[model samples]
Target: MKAADFASASPSAIRAMIGRGEWTGPTPGMAKGHVQANLVILPRDWAYDFLVFAQRNPKPCPILDITEPGDSEPSIVAPGADLRIDLPRYRIWRDGELVEEPTEITSHWRDDLVGFLLGCSFSFEGALLEASVPVRHIECGCNVPMYRTDIACRPAGRLSGPMVVSMRPIPASLVTRAVLATGRFPAVHGAPVHIGDPALIGIEDIARPDFGDAVPINEGDVPVFWACGVTPQAALMASRPPFAITHAPGHMFICDPKDSDYAVF
Candidate 1:
């Protein structure tokens, strides 16, 4: 299917494509009005600590849906959806080291694992498009650019790391409109954290992103950064949890809720 078709597809259609291994790329514009999420799975023993970490850092780690230990289905956000295979890609970590990037994790699935679905910035892009704000990556039909920042998240138990952010080059004229459109949905990443120089956030080179593909910053465009759901993977890297799983950067898990479900207005 053409990439443009994803923008109008239903969440289940998107998820079906993912589950069947047909659509395994960045999910930026897929199922346009539905919510997308960041995935973090941990053992039951470490679930509470990560939960605390999410609470301490709501902007980057807003919780959307979490599954009980041993459950692959996230009943609250997408009933009948399988976390083990619904996402386009996953990061598998062992002893805090990234071991593999897999399309499906059914082979690695364990009964004691708990799934945490964090709100993704993609959830707010529909609002931005509706408000006439340009989401460049989507326009270019590529993955959103993401980077790790020097900013530290409050340490909670065994989890702590620098916040990661997704960058969008907004037309300078619509920067406020972009912010205002997103700020209404705190459940997803809300507003911009950094607006100008990437260097301020320790991003030395905007062209070379740590994760996802870099899109062009057109003339008169300003780089805008939003706290990202991938922040937890940064924590997993730092804290070195024995076993953890996360969604690959820019490849999010599509949820059942509409963008309006999380919007303030």
Candidate 2:
């Protein structure tokens, strides 16, 4: 189904389609008002440090829900959903190196693994759209561009790396409105971390992104950056944990709560 088809679909319905292998694309405009979360599964020993990492760097790694050791469901946000297969795609890490991109991780599941549901910026797109701010990637039907920056995250245990950010091209006129709209949902990355120049953030190329496809920025559009949940993947690369699993950039685990459920007011 095209992206519009999912605008009114329930979160569970989207998950079911993903689990059944019907839709495997990036989930930008899907399940309109529901929350979508970034996934991270780590061994019990590594979960603590990651939790700390999230706390220290909440802008890029806000915590949503975390499952108990040996469990696959994120009961707080996505109850009754299987973390192993509900997302469109996942990235497997071994000692910090990305080794596989799979649709489902059933074979890789472990009894000692713990799943964490991190707040995702995708949850705020509905707000942006409602506020009359355009999300270019969604308009172009592609993934939002993401980049790794020189800004360092406060280290937690052995996890340390540059912060990762997702960029959207907001028309010059709507920058403030976009910021104000997204600022209400702090649970899912609230507002633009930087607006205007990309160089100040160490992102050298706006046309080329480290993760996800680049979307066209119109003549009057200004590039906007937000702390991305993909920051953990950078942490994984730097820390080189023995085992880890995360959603592929642009892919997310849909949750049951409304986007308004996370709004501050």
Candidate 3:
């Protein structure tokens, strides 16, 4: 389905398509006003440290909903949704290395596994659009550019790494407005973490991101970065727990919660 088609699709419908393997792509523009989430699954033994990591670093890993050990159903976000088959794509990690990217992970599900659903910036893109702030990646029909930064996350047991950020080139004139618009949704990765020089954040080249696609920056645009949900995946890679699972970058879990449910103001 095209981006426009997904703009009006229901969260349940989107999940169904993903379950059926009919749609396997980035979910930015899908289920427009709903909350979309980043997925992280780890063995029960490793979940505590990750939970502490998310609590300490809420901006990069806002905990939306967490499943009971061995349960794939995300009861809080989407009660009937089966996380293992509901997202378009998933990444499997073994010993800190990405071993596979698959359309579904039912075969990899384990009884000792715990699933985490973290807030995604995609939840606030609607607000940005409503306020007339341009979301460049949606406009360009591409994935938002993401970079690994020099900022260090507080360590929790074995989970620790530099933060990752997603960038959108905003018109210089609307930078503050963009910040205000997104800041209202703290549950999502809200507001700009960095507003200017990419190099200051250890992003050497704006054209080459550590993750996602690169979009063009217009002459009057300024790069605005937000703490990304992908940050935990970076930590997973750095710490290399024996096994883990996460959403493929851009391919997120569409939740039934309205974006307004997460808005603070």
Candidate 4:
């Protein structure tokens, strides 16, 4: 399908494309208006601790919908959507290391696995665009820049690591507008976590991001950072769980809920 085709497609239709391997790329601009989510599947034994960790670290790990152990469908977010094959790509972690990046995980799916869908910033990017705040990565046709920060998350059992942040260079004049626009969607990472000086957050080189592609920061733009959903993947790598699964950076699960459904006001 053409890029425009995917851009205008329905959530279920886009998922169908992913299921059939017709599209295996970042999902930032697809299924506009629908809420997109970050996937993190863990063994049942580890679910409770992860849930608690998410509760304590709401900025990076806003829980959207969780699945029953062994259940592939995210009944609350997208009743009939299957988590195993709906996303374009997935990262499989073993003993805290990413062992494989796969398009489908049905073969690896386990009966003891519980899926957690976290709110994703892509859900609120639409709001930013509507408010006339530029999303540089989207404008440049690249994945949003993400970096590992010095800020540490409160530990929950085996999940503890520095927070990861996604960066967008907003024009200085519209920084407040960008904040208010995204602030309305608390479920999808609410508002800006840090607003200036990448160095302050331990990011020495803004051009070299730890994950995703780096977009150019034009003159008059201020680097704005938001807590990222990928934060859990970093924690998993640190804790080195025997097995885990997550959406590949920039790839996401599209849900039936509208972005407005997650707005606070």
Residue-level lDDT tens digits of model 4 in 1-265: 5545577789888888788998998787688788888899999998998999899999999999999999999999888889999998999998888899999999999999999999988877889999999899988887889999999999998789999999999999999999999999888899999999999989999999999898999999999999998887678678877999999877899998899999999
Task: Count the clashes in each prediction.
Answer: 1, 0, 1, 0
Between candidates 1 and 3, the lDDT winner: 3
Clashing pairs in 4: none
For each candidate, the alpha-carbon lDDT, in order, equals 0.88, 0.89, 0.90, 0.90
The best-first sequence of candidates by TM-score reads 4, 3, 2, 1
Instruction: Report the alpha-carbon TM-score of model 4 versus the true structure.
Output: 0.93
- For model 3, residues 1-265, the per-residue Cα lDDT tens digits are 4755888889998899889999988787788888988899999999999999999998998999999999999999999999999998899999988899999999999999999999988777888988899999988877789999999988899889999999999999999999999999888988878999998989999999888899999999999999998898788778889999999877889999999999899
Per-model TM values vs. the true structure: 0.88, 0.90, 0.93, 0.93
Q: What is the alpha-carbon lDDT of model 1 when measured against the actual structure?
A: 0.88
**Candidate 2 residue pairs that clash:** none
The candidates, ranked best first by lDDT, are 3, 4, 2, 1
- lDDT, model 4, position 151: 95
Name the 10 consecutive residues with the lowest summed lDDT in model 1: 1-10
Error of 3 at 84 (Å): 1.8
Best by TM-score: 4
| Model 2 spans with C-alpha error above 4 angstroms | 20-25
